[model samples]
Target: MNYRHVYHAGNFADVVKHVALVAILLHLKKKDAGFAVLDSHAGRGVYDLTGEEAARTGEARAGVARLMDLRDEMPPALATYLQLVKEGGPARYPGSPLLAARLLRTQDRLTAIEKHPEEFAALKDALAPYANAAVENGDGYARAVKLLPPPSRRGLVVFDPPFESPDEFETLAQAIRDAVRKFANGIFLIWYPIKSQAAADAFTGEVLAGGVQKALTVDTQISAPEGNLDRAGLLVINPPYGFDVEMYAAAEILAPLLRADIAVKWRAGTP
Candidate 1:
């Protein structure tokens, strides 16, 4: 409950997550049928990159700030993400909800869940203009399961928990099991901080044991080994066709700018 994303908005991890998100959303658009999106752990729909929190951390300076200058050099997916960030204005960056809202068609729907009171209020206000989207102040994990098998029958579910609780990883794994049981075909994306290679391996092992098919893990390490979070990863279950190739290409482009090592791999059960 104490975790707030304002300080780390648009950091290297955000770049990786949002870039992959943009790619997946674009893939969803290829079909004529409208699709829904559930943004579990959606923060305030937008963040101020120049705000006090952002300034104090200075994370974006080494993250989004570096990419803003290389617009033309980015891959199509990453370029699209950067353009969305730029459209948010000079000092602001769009969170997952806002980014998803921008890509949603009239027939599509988006539900953004935020449990934090103040953040929920802000999220409601930020998403007010989108009639196709709704902002709910509730537990994202619980809401995710309750809202599965959406009316559209085709959708994406994003889990971006804060990892504030010691058991968050286990909790997330359980949530995945519950959600997959209800909507087996739904695309699931889970993001986690990579503090160490061993920890990441253990988590990935647990997820692989969950029996999800076509799971791909994408990660980037921006700094040399230290006792801090210089790396982050995303686990995508049932990713879109060709998404793995596109994500690897995007990570290659982002690695040098952020001084990160990129690792792209297919976990067990992937096919």
Candidate 2:
């Protein structure tokens, strides 16, 4: 089955991806110098929870709904993500583009790319309100390499492909390496699914061999690898100053709610 992101828009995978996305975006906000955000495979930038796709899966009910229910009591990182969701109301979700756009100051810029025609249109529409945000309809993998080392020389790049094709692994890995080669100093965040321990681990090895100086991989195993909802992970290169600490606190709160055998680990050459 093709994995339409709308079906899993706010699910556990998204929870991990979005929360980490928010954390890194927050770090970019700390500095006075203007920064940029390039979202590869940006999805639609917004999802209608009440639509046929989302309603059919009802995944958001479990993901975003659960997050919303616990918003008032959530840890700091989760609470921040929830704050953005709350702005969209119960019927919608703010994808990474919107989330990063909200955090951007006048000096900051955002360029989001999506290949799916329908989703790309929605991405443009979703970001139409932001004067500094640009939404593109094209191949994210290709765009990532072209948009790297932006003029600002400081920014975060998010690679969140649909992973519809198996070859996406090699493509994503090389695309990341290409982007890093041009801007090793910029922060890179790659979101991926946890299909199996070995597959995911091997991918991490590929990322390591890609030449990023400081990198961290965070994987959460929610269930046995028997179903689509099994697991998810995020790879960060040149991570924010305090991502690990904040992610640990966020994971502890989410683990009990997810009710999965979850663990968080860090593997890198630096603090």
Q: Pick the candidate with the highest lDDT.
A: 1
Which residue runs does candidate 2 get wrong by more than 4 Å?
A: 71-75, 224-226
Question: What would the per-residue lDDT of candidate 1 be over residues 167-241, giving only the tens digit for each residue?
Answer: 888888889888988888899889998766887788877777777777888888777334546878899988988
The TM-score values for the models, in the order shown, are: 0.95, 0.94
Each model's number of backbone clashes?
0, 0
Cα displacement (Å) at residue 257, model 2 = 1.7
Instruction: State the number of backbone clashes in model 2.
Output: 0
Compared with the true structure, what per-residue lDDT tens digits does model 2 show for residues 173-252? 88988899999999998988877778888888988887767888777666533445667788989988888888888888
Write down the lDDT of every candidate, Cα atoms only.
0.87, 0.82
